[model samples]
Target chain A: MKTLKIIKIGGNIIDNEAALSSFLEVFATINSPKILIHGGGKLATQLANQLGLEVKMIDGRRITDKATLDLITMVYAGKINKNIVAELQSKNCNAIGFSGADGNTIISKKRPVKPIDFGFVGDVKKVNIETLQVLLEHKVTPVFCALTHDKKGQLLNTNADTIASELAIGFAKYYQTELYYCFEKNGVLRDVSDENSVIREITTQSYQNLIDDKVIVDGMLPKLNNCVHAIEKNVYKVCIGKPEMLYDDKANFTTITK
Target chain B: MKTLKIIKIGGNIIDNEAALSSFLEVFATINSPKILIHGGGKLATQLANQLGLEVKMIDGRRITDKATLDLITMVYAGKINKNIVAELQSKNCNAIGFSGADGNTIISKKRPVKPIDFGFVGDVKKVNIETLQVLLEHKVTPVFCALTHDKKGQLLNTNADTIASELAIGFAKYYQTELYYCFEKNGVLRDVSDENSVIREITTQSYQNLIDDKVIVDGMLPKLNNCVHAIEKNVYKVCIGKPEMLYDDKANFTTITK
Candidate 1:
């Protein structure tokens, strides 16, 4: 199988222009057949505040009402995605930007309203592997925003972590896929505040032990869980680290294994 | 040569929800090998007002400074383009949205400051016909927002009329192309007030006569000029009228020819 890397970058890099530029420089040098997925940075909330839309949040996840969804569509899919594509193009990376709606590449169902109705939020249904594969074969790098769509004319707010995991799993059937979750941190840390205390490797047993010891909790918990899930689903490699790891041969980051 | 239809829609249909839905419903049924190019519409201006961003206009053209350019990116490429794509998908049309930056499909140079300093606007330099052909071959209808990118990381505000013309000219090399400019009016009118006074045919000679006679003046002149330009560039057909003409084989509209 051909090797393909699916890299996901969160808001930490996106919110800082210099960091994003530096990150893309590293991403551009990756050998070939790589995809970049980005999360909407703080701009959405800032724009929402400017537009006087109340952002309802239930436990860290945003309650994506119609107005909020529209705001995110404009911010994430429009502004950030295009900017990234243009920047990558400057670096000679042929980047193609996508919302789930584009080419119907990602179809998702709206989250069921039984417990908590996260307005226009969608859980991933499927990724159009053929379309993505064709683009990759043509040497086109896809830059995806954190948005999906129901096939019936609705754009849904989706988690970027989930999107990354889903895409890695989707591509696993055809490629030896490596999934990287790039954020601000160096890696999963033994101490959250001390960046130097990075845990170099994490296995499923180690992850369970970390959780039992309360070393990994909150937002990081779900993200770590996603990494484990991707690895189990046959994504060749899974790593969590800063963007520099893309180019660094001796990069110290948390690597997840079965 | 294979035949392809390229359609451009102005803001009137886009500004109204029901009208846009109606337009998409009609656009959806058009046979394969068609593209849709849409303008930003009044939503950008309305949102600008709400955000207190001053929309600077010079002789009816927006002076796209950085803020205004960002606003339009969110509105034109994000909201409107995605909405149209999703709606077309609902109607079973596999629509893909594009910014010039995406796939480097359309590359432009920032408009020269000598003329009036139309800030971030761009003039079309080249259209990547290969990328577009690939998408079209895959049965994807590309819906373009009126924005292009300079290869060095800048998105420029481009005119939809020019973008439509450029695409028609580009596609003419591989396909017998028909370009349609869809706006609010029935067609080019003998009198601006009367919608029923639609001119049935307009050849280059007759179009010049209409101008000398002062029947076609103001905004309609440049549009007709674009039509004439497209027709002369060997686009098989060029028509200007309301959106309904896409599906109306017997639609009475002004047809442009050499």
Candidate 2:
């Protein structure tokens, strides 16, 4: 089976133009077939503020009301996705931008109202690997925005990290898939204050130990959990770190495995 | 050769939800290999106004400055295109939305800054028919936004009518293409004041006569001219009028032929 790399970039890396351009330069050089999943940056929040739309949140996760959903759809799928595709194209990378709505590539279910209503948020229900395989087979790279559709005509806001993990799991059936979650951090640190204390690797056994020690808390918990979930679902390995981890073998990144 | 329909819908249909929905419903029923090209709706300008940005226009054509370009990319490619794709998907049409940058499907030349510096406006230069043909052969219908790229990482605002015509011309080599320009008015009116005076069929000779008699003027001139250009370029036929003309011959429309 051919090796496929799925890389997810968080808003911190995407928020800065020079950082994004530099990261894309490295991203364009990866020899294996790859998929890029990008998060919504600060610009969407800034634009929402300018438009007088409140950035509703509960538990640090956003509540994507219809207005916020539209804003992110524009910012993520529109401006950010297309710009990334264009930049990749300039590097001779054949890239196409997509939301899940395109080609019915990813159909998601709107979170039920039983719990706190998350408005238009969706949890991905399906990834049409066959549809994506067509693009990969043609050597066309897909740049995805964190948005999915319900197949009933509503675009829902989704988590970019979850999207990457789900995609890796789906493609794992036909390929040795490696998932990379790229953000501003060096890696999962041993001590919260010590940036240099990067944990090189974490197995399922050690992940629970870190969680018990309170070192793995907050946003890192969900992200690390996603990594473990992907690995369990047949992904060869999952890495969490800065975007440079893709190229530099010694880069500070935490590798998660069974 | 297979029959293909290339339809361009102006802002009139898109701005009104009911109308756009009705038009799309009719569009989804067309069984031929088809492509839909859409013009930017009034939402972009409305957004510009909300953002307090000046919309510069010369002789009714927009000057796409950097800000304007970003605005349209958001509204057209992000909001409008994805929504349309989602809607079509709900109707069981496997539609994929595209900006020219996607899959490098359409490449345009930035209009030279000779007499008029149109900022980021582009003229259709090339269409990657093979890339598009792949979608057609796979039963995936494409929905295009009126934005093209210069391959140098710039998305250029393009005229939707021109995009439709260029696509029709390019696809004519492989398919018997019919182009439709769906707009607000009934068709080319024989009398400026009479709504019922639609010119049923226009040939090269009759089109010249219509212009000689002062019937064809203003924006319709350029639109009708595109229709004639598509005819000369081997598109089997070109129709201009309400979208209903696609399914209803009794509906008012002007059919152009060489």
Candidate 3:
């Protein structure tokens, strides 16, 4: 089977210009089919603050009210996605930007109001692999922003990490898919502050032990869980680390195995 | 040759929620191959005002400095483009949103600085007919925002009307293309103040007569010129006026022909 790589980059890389440029330069060199999913950066909140829109947060997840949804849609899907596409294009990689609504590639369900109504937040219900497969087969790389649609004409805010995982699993049916969660830190550090103390590999068996030891707490916990979820779903491989880990296996990063 | 309809919607319809919805309803019913190109709405300027970004104008044309370019990219490509795609998706149009960078569909040259320095504005240079044909052949309708990329990784502001005309002309080589400029006003009104005074058909001979008589002036002149330009470039038909004119012959609109 052909191999496909699904890479996700968080705000730490996106918010930094030099870092994003370096990352794209490396990303352009991957000859295998790949998809890039990016998160909304600090610009949304900064713009929200500038416009005096109160960002309501419950349990750390952003409340995507109509206003917030609009803001993030503009920031994530528009400015950032297109810029990344242009950057990749300049590097000779044909990159296409997507908000799940485009091509009806991803249809999601709005989170039910009974469960702490996250407003426009969505849970993935389906991924139309046909459109994505067409682009990929044509050697086009898709750059997706953290957004989805309900097919009922409403845009929904989504987690970029979940999008990466969903796409990896969805494509795994046809290709040997590897998922990468590329962020700023050296993956799954033994000590959060010590960048060099990286955990080399993690299995489901060892995951709980690490969690219990408090080595992977806070935000890293959900991210690690996403990696494990992808692995359980038959994704060929999953990793979390700095973007450089793509070309450098020796780079400090955590590999997730089933 | 196969037939293709290329439609452009200006700000008047886009700035209005009800009007845009009605327009999309009709646009979705276009059984033939079609593409929708939309102009940036007033929301960009409004948001810019909210963010205290001064919009500079030179000789009635907005100068697209870096900040303004970013603002429009967000509003036009991000918000307006995606929402339109979602609306069309709900209507079962299978819509896909694009900034020229996507699939490298439209590559443009940044306007030269010698000519009054329009900042990041661009002039259309090439259109990748292959990508558009691929989508159209698959029954996918492309929804484009008025922005193009300079191949070297820069997104530039472009005129929606020009983009519409250019695409129609580009596709005319392979398809009998009809171009529509849909806005709120009735087509080429004999009297600007009188909505009822719509010109039925405008050929090269009559167009000059109208211009000489001071009937077509201001913004409508440039728009009519775009119509004539597309017509001269062998486009099958070019129409300008209300969006409903798409299906209704009784609808008041102007048709341009050589």
Candidate 4:
């Protein structure tokens, strides 16, 4: 069986045209089956500002109100979805972009943060893995934006980390795939700000220690949680590293172990 | 047989909070079966501008590029999808928000426009009526955003008018529904600037005359085209009127006829 890989690219990668092009080149050369998920932080923030809507954040997570959620759907699922598709096509990669809402691939429930209602933010409750499997079987790489539909048939804004994690678990359980999370940082650093001090490996004990020490904070915290969850679900491996170093054994990447 | 209706609300309706609330109140009162489709044009365009992206428009239609498309997906599918769902819920109406990509409900092909490439825009090629039917059967009003997915799994930015038309035709064919297009304007005006000069009805003959007189130009062209297409497809009626007058017989609405 060909090993399947699920990877996530960040807003940093998509915003920089040069980075996007170079990444596409590398993406096209990869021979194994893979899936790509992406984020649109800068775009979302900028749009929120333009619409005179104040950007809301709850514990570093975007508070998706009615206005902000509309902006997000347009950017992530509509615009980013197609742009990524066109970019991959230009690079000779057969990439197709979609969202969690497509084919009911990701069924979510509204995340109503009590005392503060985030109008459209969602926490994924279920995933229709079969839908994703069908797409992969057709030999097309699926690119997903982190947006999902609620029980009421409404689309809600979801965190990319949450989306990537859920999808990793979904792919792992369904296809037994490995999950690799690629970002700008070298890897899981022992020192959060020190890129060169990459932690070689993270055991269940070390993972807990890092959280206790308050080093793995904000966005990275959810990502780490996802890694732990993926490993717990018996995925082959979960790696956190730079995009180019994803496949390198000697690269500064964190091997998350159960 | 119970009558089915597909009502499309414009951005202008949503922009006004009081008006939206009033409209939703009236909408919830309707005992008949109905589906809602909506747009967030003003919000999307404003966000596009703040992101340093030049809001590109060719003859009033948004010329969607990579960045713009991303903005739109985030707003339309993500944010607006949730708002509508929340509003309906507030009115105790069972509503679900969705994008065309969801459940493969709306499948499309990337429209290859020569000279200027509209990055992620698509023309509606097919619709999954069964999925929608099942939802409607369960008494869930599916609120749809104008975003769609291509066969290649790419999400495309589509015109709201096009989406509404295709959806109307699909619903009409599948469940034999009435298609209602509600906008800020009273109806199709005989004179562009006069609000009271609403055309009561438009037939194929009058439509041609309007086009010949250049009265039906710009954004109205696509809308008129969609109206004609729906009528041609044997929709019971394609009614164009103001949001508040949707249920009123004396409403200045135009009916497109063969």
lDDT score of model 2?
0.90
Compute the lDDT for candidate 3.
Answer: 0.92
Q: Each candidate's lDDT (Cα)?
A: 0.90, 0.90, 0.92, 0.75
lDDT of 4 by residue, B1-258 (tens): 457888888888877878877888888677777888888757777655666679877765568887776667767865566556656755667665566765466778988888667677888999766656765665667788888877454678887788888887887755666888888899899887899898889997889999999888987888899999888887778888897567776778788998
What is candidate 4's fraction of native contacts?
Answer: 0.21
Model 3, residue A175: what's the lDDT? Answer: 98
Query: What tens-digit string does per-residue lDDT give for candidate 3 at B14-121?
Result: 999999999999999999999999998899999899999998998988999999999999999999999999999999999989989998988999998886898999
Using all chains and alpha carbons, the TM-scores for the candidates as numbered come to 0.98, 0.97, 0.97, 0.63
DockQ of 4: 0.15
Which lDDT tens digits does candidate 2 get at residues A98-169?
889888989999999767899998999998877678888888888999999999999999889999999999
Clashing pairs in model 2? Answer: none
For A91-152, candidate 3 gives per-residue lDDT tens digits of 99998899889889889999999869889999999988788888898899999999999999
Which predicted model would earn the best lDDT?
3
Candidates sorted on lDDT, descending? 3, 1, 2, 4
lDDT of 3 at B214: 93
Interface alpha-carbon RMSD, every candidate: 0.8, 0.9, 0.7, 7.0
